[model samples]
Target: MESERYIRQTILKDFGLKSQKKLTKARVLVIGVGGLGIPVLQYLNAMGVGTIGLIDNDVVSLNNLHRQVLFSEKDINKTKISVAIKKLKKQNSTSKLIGYKLYLSKKNALSIIEKYDLIVDASDNFPTRYLVNDACVILGKPFVYGALHSFEGYVSVFNHKDGPTYRCLFPNPPKSEEIPNCNEQGVLGVIPGIIGNIQALEVVKVIAGIGSPLSGELLIFNGLEQEYHKFKINSLSKNKKIEELKDTYELECSFDNSSISSDAFKELLNSSTEIQLVDVRTTEEYNDYHLKQATHLPLKSIYLNHNSLDFEKTIYFICQSGVRSLEALRFLKKEQPEATLISINGGLNEFRNYDAKH
Candidate 1:
């Protein structure tokens, strides 16, 4: 390790050379390289974390630029893992940066996480959060968790030294309709940075055995009002009883069987030219461009105006990406259980890509 590079940190009273050495020996695996993961990786790598692993299958898009500040218009369409690793290497050549260009699924979570000293749950979705929790509990590892929603964000360290796991805080995932992701709801570009930095600090504390980690306590930050709150998370024996990862981490909100690929969706359009299709995006997004013959309705409008929609017909939903469309499908499933609803997987982006290839 370059002692001069981290001299500022090494000179701290409690966090002296010993802590610096601990950081150099630590291996941390970050689950995503988007808005939150970028900051975590940057800080950890700069501070001399020995091995940093990032796993993500997503490609950079125009929308991602607003919050995932690491990527620019030039980097759009590039794989996030590759782009992040390339930039991070330039930031710190000494830190061993590893990139996994794939989504974290039940099949791979355990095998990958077992190799790391600590895991950083920088993922945006709930299923991944639960998967990280269960895997960490099973492998006897600790993980730092961070999440963002609009102007507010949450941070906590789970499964550290027999501490409370994420399941202890949330025993069950919320119903699909109860919570909307940042993609659907929207978030300030800076919120994830604030939350991510806190997560990185927690990771450092846990690794170096210095300050108190956020284990057994959840930190809530509201950027709008600039308020911070902490809630105690009581450990539950049942949560720590995981013997293995679940067969699948897709939550109740998932639209696996009910989702159609962009190519299949095109075939359906060709077969039935008059098929019902709805585009659930903001008015501005819909106004900018939309699929031909698609009815425009924002996500909240779908929830509020469900009575007007024809439940008798099989309705196909589309969004800028597929996120909001999935939310739309989930909402309608509860309101009209018998209604045949399908979300266009990968949404407009995938549809355009399909059009480009053909």
Candidate 2:
């Protein structure tokens, strides 16, 4: 009877009826219902995972539709967890699914984590990744971690049977500017799907105690070359015990918000009496379309041409999205400390959306 449900998986000797039973009894929590969380949630639910909890404070956006397959144009502006829950319920009515529409913080991390047997980190920010790792470590819960850049992705399972945490691999987070997010660099729709599925596989392995788990190992995938590389995570580095979870993880670590909304930019546009708009995206991106009354200043030439820009005027920086604008704003702020500067939230995408509606 169960064979029909997981016929392909049950055919494998490593994961037969015994493993399917374990999966049916497992409870898992997926944090961040973004690109990675979508596929991970779908496969786990389809595999007959008994209970699943999804946590996300963000709402779906037009840009997200390219990579986040679970959502559609209809889901735009709807809370991610709410939309995800409805879809998952339709996919599998038997699974007990829960959704948390609030952001994950230290205060509620442990409590939210306590109900689950395992956790999945699908967040893009560094602080949240660390916070999730620390909370999982303290709660003694295993977590499947995944992160993606332009065309590369990383997947690992941390704190499983005393394995190394994320910090053990990299004690310090990279400077915010050095690492560009999907908003700036752009990611292929298939990259996150591939990584998220691997994450789901690791979770199933952990739950069923079947095939070799990714614990103490990090798998890297390059979409450009379609190559996969596995490296042993340095387990002996230091397994720090997380005794307490703090309330404010963002304040302690760097978080990027270069993808601000056009509505937010419009608010600043209306409020500021004397602000100059600066567009730092590529010439082609700017030529494709841009905000009215904005000047194109490619990022590569910012240092050389910034001197020509009037320091007297308040600057409102913009880009294809918000990432380059933040970098531009930071550069201008440092060069002329007294000059007032602000980043146009969500860059041109938000601006175009607002303009089209009005």
Best by TM-score: 1
State residue 49's C-alpha deviation in candidate 1, in Å: 0.3
Per-model lDDT: 0.87, 0.82
TM-score of 1: 0.72
lDDT of 2 by residue, 1-358 (tens): 5568688988888788888888889999999898899999999999999999999999999999989999999999999988999999999888899899897876578899989999999988877888898898888899999999999999999988867778778765664676788788899998999999999999998999977788888889999999999988776534556687642355334334323345544755565545577789898877777766677799888977687578786666888667888888787677888886767656676665554211
Tell me the TM-score of each prediction against the true structure. 0.72, 0.70
Cα RMSDs, all models = 10.6, 11.1
Least accurate stretch of 10 residues (summed lDDT) in model 2?
Answer: 251-260
Candidate 2 structure, TM-score to reference: 0.70
Question: Which residues of candidate 1, in runs, are more than 4 Å off?
Answer: 255-358
**Candidate 1: which pairs clash?**
none
